[model samples]
Target: MTMFSTIRLRAAAVLASFALALSGCFLSPGKFTSELVFTGPDSFTFSYEGEIFFLGLSKLAQMDAAQAEFTPPECYNQETYESQECSAEELADARANWESGAADRAAEAKKKAEQMAAMMGGIDPSDPKAAEELVKRLKRQKGWERVVHKGDGVFDVSYRVTGTMGHDFMFPLIEGFPATNPFVQTFVRQGGQVRINAPGFATQNPEQAGMGAMMGIGSLAGLAAMRAELDGQGDAMPGIPVIDGTFTVRTTRGMRVLANNTDEGPEPNNTGEALTWRITTRTAQAPTALIALIP
Candidate 1:
């Protein structure tokens, strides 16, 4: 597999794990509320407040184990997986088995850790310090300043990125793995306004894109089932994992939205100042939701 394909496969595995963990639950992973307040033509205050639900204690343990087992290769560590001399076959195998291997390895590690914990009289799930090490690991990133356990399988985290917006700002929801799953909610600035470009997942790989199109068609079929279930026209189909979120943009005082591709969220106010794009279900759509603003 090519480097890009490897990256895409890695991302798919992580997302698949997330979906399984959040399946059948009302809370899907976590809710993110972010604000991008433009301070100048080229600068902004990026604040994000969110929580990531672990679902169960075992899930947390599994995540820790998976992270330990899957340390990125030296080439990946240097952000040059494509150019490095790493064995392509090794990378291909890793990608092929990442999902199942992650689960199996995590289960084995969890079993061993459980045995040790039993001998040590077990660790309290409610112990704040239990998650401290993981929090520290997460905070090692440049913009992540705070990551705290907020009780009940939830983690309260916040981060800020401040500077002139370069070509684009990418916030990797999952990093350190083969594919850094960065979510780019903001686009290149164009004369006092920012554009919302296509999401990376939509174009990560041609094969994946084609697969996504097929999945989208499947989702439409699922949607029909959902409507039928609501109307008592048919039985409910298996649920598709739907990742949902909202992106809010606040331009400088005098700026306003110029154009948008989505009508899911409220339109720019009469003052033409701000807009929010609500991503209801980011399963297989193009993933590109554009919005341009201008002063």
Candidate 2:
């Protein structure tokens, strides 16, 4: 399992505990609490109430991709054969080509991430205005605000999907959090905005029938695992993981609107039609000041 998977398990446990306490359904051994105060030059203050515990982020991008492939049969190609489809000998050649292309993409992503890191430089995390300024910059860049502050633990980031708008927002990490993840989390500001990238999952949501046809080679779970799984294994590969990026804002009240746009997609047919996802996040802390930097 990746460090994130493990953290998710733990975070879930915390939420479970909170749920129990809130319900008064059963007594718990203890109650935990933390206070996050945000202040800004705009004279903003955000305060979080209750025993806040980290909740592992649900990957909206992965979920949407699954939805796109699952609920709509019309969205994907059901054909059994294409040039990409071929005999075992030909499949080998195609696989080699795909792998080469994937490698180039991976190299590019790595370089971009490195360049971003290099631009952040130094900033004191303990500064009183740090969090506020950070949030403001993130909003300006339209980046993610899915952050998990674990006191002295590593800062976990969950970025929003690249293409999602409003509530339809989804997240596809640059790389999904590893089963064993670690980081010296920092924020980067550029061109009056902030940029952030999170780990992502690699997967393919082929038509069920089409996908099942190849399952004899490896299970769906195996194929969806990650790049590490495909390194030396002789199994079919999964699609490259989706990367999510976003702009986020902190609100004085928990209420927030990740305003949906007409450009998002074809509008819903009616109130009952499938709805487009909007990407929005609510932090435990009320935003005291808006920060528009990258994460």
TM-scores for all candidates: the values are 0.45, 0.21
Question: In lDDT terms, how accurate is model 1?
Answer: 0.46
TM-score, predicted candidate 2 vs. hidden true structure: 0.21
lDDT of 1 by residue, 207-293 (tens): 444323322212322222232333453323223222345556656555545565545543445433455655443333333433343
Off by over 4 Å in 2: 1-44, 48-86, 119-295
Q: Write the per-residue lDDT of candidate 2 for residues 57-139, one digit (tens) a residue.
A: 11211121222221211121235422232345544664566556665555653543343222222222334444344334434
lDDT of each: 0.46, 0.25
Q: What is the lDDT of residue 76 in candidate 2?
A: 16
Which 10 consecutive positions of candidate 2 have the poorest summed lDDT? Answer: 24-33
